[model samples]
Target: MSKSQGYDERLAVPLRWWAQGTMLVATLWLTVVVAVPGPTAWVVTGVALALLALLLWSYGDARVVVRDGWFQAGRARIEAEYVGEVAALDAEQTRLVAGRDADARAYLLLRPYLHRAVKVEVVDPADPTPYWLVSSRHPEALADALTALPKTR
Candidate 1:
């Protein structure tokens, strides 16, 4: 089967979050430079930089893509035929699905920082997973793509 992309997006950490994290790292470095003795301050800064780099690296790879009749969120991919009831959720609803009323059997690709998300019901009876809750910066678009899977297939 020919693979074609229907919707592709990375739920990137917002720019403001990057800015805030950078500022926080700088603050920690400055605090260390002022209070800590010896070369420990520079060591602390290096460790902080390493941690920041690791954080950005991991966050950068997470993506949501609809292609080849499949929907991928983070590390999980499900065929479009098994995806149903695509719901675009606002911040409050997203939080509720991801937190308070969350199901243990549901697959979640959530980013707590991203307020918007899409909930897709899984129709495969053999699969124990009931649904997938995924973070999306463009929830409506993601939901639309998911709902339109039948046409794409």
Candidate 2:
């Protein structure tokens, strides 16, 4: 098991995705070189590569963190006091929850690349969102960290 820094996880895309993306960019470079065949082709390929890099970096920048009496998934956060009933979901369970049994008002921090997730119930009655479904590579660890949080309320 990994040491818990209060359960911090970055949802990075797999390396295979990077490899495939790079190959695609190479293909784009080839097409541009064959069609245009000048400095314009180099410029076009460079811009396309830069854009691809930026998109992948931004897409993988999302994070899930639980620390200092708070839980966060991507841009959304909630106090630990308001969190309840954390569950670690396997691939099948996550698919079912995210697809068949999803609540309309639930806050989901889902990534297509991630198949496992953690379901966190929101106990705050004032909040409109019912629960949070956050994708995690290590869902059990995340659930354990969340469960260990001290609820002030």
Candidate 3:
């Protein structure tokens, strides 16, 4: 929730993911130290840890926002005028929509950690994408915000 009148959510990776990544880096440090037994091992471990941090930070930086009559997920955005029906999906429904019943042309902003999602139909005649399936921790809130958008068209 920013100062703007809209919904904003950051899809940050879970703490467990960071813990697991740190453990993996620690294991690599141990293995390297055992094999090389010098400053070279320390340097290698430092590099590995830095790279892991960079990767996790970038991967978890995706954002979903509904503001100023627009819906944005990651790098894609659509005006409210072109937004159609919106639905908040539970874990089971999200699985089905993202897997079994998924459209090839649909825009997807899925995350393995987030089981729930919001499905928003694209009403624009010019767009090839049929809809957007975006993973959200608060799918219901996201759906409500999207549904409340003022469709000027």
Per model, how many backbone clashes are there?
0, 0, 0
Report the Cα lDDT for residue 11, model 2.
Answer: 97
| The candidate that achieves the highest lDDT relative to the unseen native structure | 3
The residue-by-residue lDDT of candidate 3 on 58-138, one tens digit each, is: 888999999999999999999999999999999999999999999999999999999999999999999999999999999
Residue pairs in clash, model 1: none
Q: Residue 58 deviation, candidate 2, in Å?
A: 0.6
State the lDDT at 119 in candidate 3: 96
Query: How would you encode candidate 1's per-residue C-alpha lDDT over 32-119 as one tens digit per residue?
Result: 9999967999899889988987797688669999876889999899998889788999999998898899999999888867888999
Candidate 1 global TM-score: 0.83
TM per prediction: 0.83, 0.96, 0.96
What lDDT score goes with residue 144 in model 2? Answer: 93
What would the per-residue lDDT of candidate 2 be over residues 39-99, giving only the tens digit for each residue?
A: 9988998898899889998999999999989999999999999999999999999999999
lDDT at position 68, candidate 1: 65
**All candidates: CA RMSD in angstroms?**
3.4, 1.4, 1.6
Shift in Å, residue 75, candidate 2 = 0.3
lDDT value for model 1: 0.85
Output the better candidate (1/3) by TM-score.
Answer: 3
